[model samples]
Target: MSGRIPRQFIDDLLVRVDIVDLIDSHVPLKKTGSNFVARCPFHTEKTPSFSVSRGKQMYHCFGCGASGNAISFLMDYSHLGFVEAVEDLAAFVGVDVPREIGGDFSASDKEDFTRLYAVLEDVAAFYVDQLRTGDGRIAVDYLKARGVSGEVARDFGLGYAPQAWDVLLGRFERDALIDAGMLVVREDGKVYDRFRGRLMFPIRDKRKRVIGFGGRVLDDSLPKYLNSPETAIFSKGKELYGLCELLQKKSRPERILIVEGYMDVIALAQYGVANVVATLGTATSKTQIDMLFRYASELVFCFDGDNAGRQAAWKAVDAALSCLRDGRQIKIMLLPQGHDPDSLIRDEGKAGFEQRIEQAQVLSDYFFDFLAGPLNLSSIEGRSQLMTAARPQVEKIPPGYFKDMMWRRLRELAGSRVVELPEKPSTLNRQFQGKVGKAKTQRPSLGRRVLALLIQRPELAQVLAQRHLSLEGLKFAGQELLEDVLRRIALEKPENGAILLEAYRGSSYEKTVNALAGVELDIPEGGEEAEFFGAVIQLLKQSRQEKLTELLAKEGREGLNAEEKQVLRALLRERL
Candidate 1:
């Protein structure tokens, strides 16, 4: 096993994998002629413009201009990392990824993930078995007392961890159990089950695989709820309690209701409101917000009306500031004091609970109300304070209609004491700067042409290499990058364009290489070799001409050195 996945395997996987089939599994594609077309999943569009070319094993969206191969498509659509995408493709094709044995990659890195997930699954089963046994009466009674039916209990994979500490210790290997976050090792080196005598709720990912657990005590415990410690498989800030189940109900629900606890989600589902999720004992995160927005446009947060609930709602607002965009909405719902979503929903039935969600305060109103709650807007001091606090939060939002409207609302609130914000460089200004740099690099230069052509048709590099072209003295902005890319292509001999792109993943020239890869050239099909060689030859000639001009100027300033004179004579002979 290698530390890094072998490059040859990745290229082979891309060659064997079908982009059309892979994408259709996620976003259905319809065959139109030799290619396939679908509504672009990356952006909202009415007509089908996303095209998948079976010949090239690549997909491109005309609407958004998003273009990539299978691996890139999976990375974008599923939000997977590059290696994970490659792993998925490898899994699809039924091949084990062979990695290099030596470097930073270790056996533990691979073994731990597999072992962790397996141990978690086994531990969840143990808890479930405990729930079914005679000793599980306490857990069963607790669920019944909470009005959780047997079917719902089973659906949520509710279980019971035994009161005995060694129950899990006896069943599984100690290290595996500890690594899965099922056991705690004290300083004395004594290990024990982390969730003893607690009713268990297995937290699953989108694949319905149990990644971690949330344990609630059957009796009076200070913490009340205990979640699995952050493990390789589970990050509290990233996972939602019932998201997998909610998504099972609706792939894209109209609106998702976010509650405060696990029971709140299960309770809401019991009451026939199935589109509810809960943050795992942590404050809502921007990552979770982004994930939820992928499934639903609107998110409604239900919190208790107490100070803690208000604090939680405010924290959610802070996290949501940077995530807000046009067409996405967030609402804050505060239940009556002394009640959480579980208690309130139980009291007010499904209809009343849902009514609260419907009448929930919009994010804009809640934001201003919370900001001004402690300040007197009539006084300049209070308004100044508001401006001081609000400006930073408002600026976190990406520029769009939402941001503009927020600014307008701030002005209305500030009234006579509106703060004049310092003008910063606009996004357009940054884009203009980038364009200027791009224009400089892309000025119909032979170097730029050759680089772009190589990225688009990397196999042409082999031909260029075979020509034994001497580009040693070539000097240009992107000349080194061009040579590096050509050298890699000539050595690796990657048959897929995505594989070539993937090779540049973390290189300094990754951005430039990707940008050039997307550049549309005027050369027709089968003319890439001619264009590539033509550009390379012209670039080399231009370098020579520039070198000759410099040497001639040096001769005028001072007599040329022996070496410089020889070079000048050879250049003059070549010119004649």
Candidate 2:
């Protein structure tokens, strides 16, 4: 694991895990002509803007700017690092991920990840063994009482931590537990267990490695739930509980059910609701929502009818709205008074639960109706109040038809009084100001735009190279992306955008390549080519002239610095 995994291993893994099969598990791709089409999972929209090319083993979401290979998709969707994604794909195909491959692979991060994985595996096993015997029976009984079945419990790798603080501390090396975020050291340098006497719910990465844990207290305790602190392998914002199993099963659950606690997930799963996961006792994050897009196109956020749960659902809805794109959808489901998914499933059975799920409303619809319910729309002052409250929320939406829809709904709900709504200040102005301030502060030299022109037209590459245009000449900060393209062109001799992009596969510039490929290119012909070059030269001359004028005005005759004076004289001499 210390050495870099070989390129051949990655290639073999990709071959084993068919791109079409892997992508289909997350996206409901329907046959559209020769390729498959689904709503882009990356952005919000009603129409499909994402497509998969099986022949090329790639996917591109035209809506929210997500485009990548199968490996990248797994990494993005599952929140697995590159190595983990590769290893998982290899294991899925029943192939071994070799610890060492003969190559000069340069990613220290990958090495760190491998080590962390080994440590986490050891920790998960320890917890599982503890749950099988000893004080872990308390945890087992607790789950059973909550309506979690043995099969579901086994499926999720649920376990328990003993009452003793050092139960896990004694089993593993001190540094290992600390590194894995399983222990907290006090001021006296004595390390105590992070999760004691609680049912252990292993939070796994998409590759099926338990990266962290969510612990549920069996007894009536303050806090009731505790989760693994953030670690190199786990970020609460990025990982979801059941994604690994869902990905492997390749089942497109019609709808995804999001709950608040581990027991909620286990109980729902016990009742054959396989597409359920808990948020580890925190608010839903964008990463979690993005991960869900990989599996279910629609997500139903189920919470209790209590005020706290309703508030939680509101937050979840807001988060979901930000992450939604063309094909994906989200809904809010409030359980009956004083009931959560766990309690409802227990009292009324799976049928009762499914019936309520069927009635879940789309988030936007729910939000509008919920807001309307409390406010009186008939009164002018009430409408004004509603607009005042809703405008801020509307402004938070990224510019799109979704924003328009919200405004339209407001108009319908408030009628002519919609004008009373506050107008959002221009974000573009804010963004421009930010960019201008940054430019003034950094004053980064512009990278050569000439290289971009050359990459777009391979025929121009030789001309630019002949002119001694290297990446250093390109003063632009993002010139690295262009340099990557030029390097690809030099080595691959790509005749077209598609070929050029293919040559960049598995390279760091894959996303850049995809973006470049998406750009429409124009290759001038005959006189037009000459005219284009002439226009470019003229623009350069004009730019130089403008700079000289500015310098002359600012510094005058005696105010000119030596280097500037020399340059000015040279330019004057050239013009003369």
Give the CA lDDT, 0 to 100, for residue 32 in model 2: 78
Q: Score every model by TM-score.
A: 0.74, 0.63
Off by over 4 Å in 2: 1-112, 417-499, 502-576
lDDT, candidate 2, equals: 0.68
lDDT by residue for model 1 (112-228), tens: 788888888888888898988976999999888888888888888889998887888888989988888888999999998898888899999876779999988888986899999
Evaluated at residue 223, the lDDT of candidate 2 is 71
Give candidate 1's error at residue 425 in angstroms: 6.2
- RMSD from true fold, candidate 2: 11.2
Instruction: Please give the distance, in angstroms, between residue 488's alpha carbon in candidate 1 and its true position after superposition.
Output: 10
For all predictions, the C-alpha RMSD in Å is 7.1, 11.2
- The TM-score, computed over Cα atoms with residue i paired to residue i, of candidate 1 is 0.74
Scanning candidate 1 in windows of ten residues, the lowest lDDT window is 428-437
Q: Against the unseen true structure, what C-alpha lDDT does each candidate score?
A: 0.81, 0.68
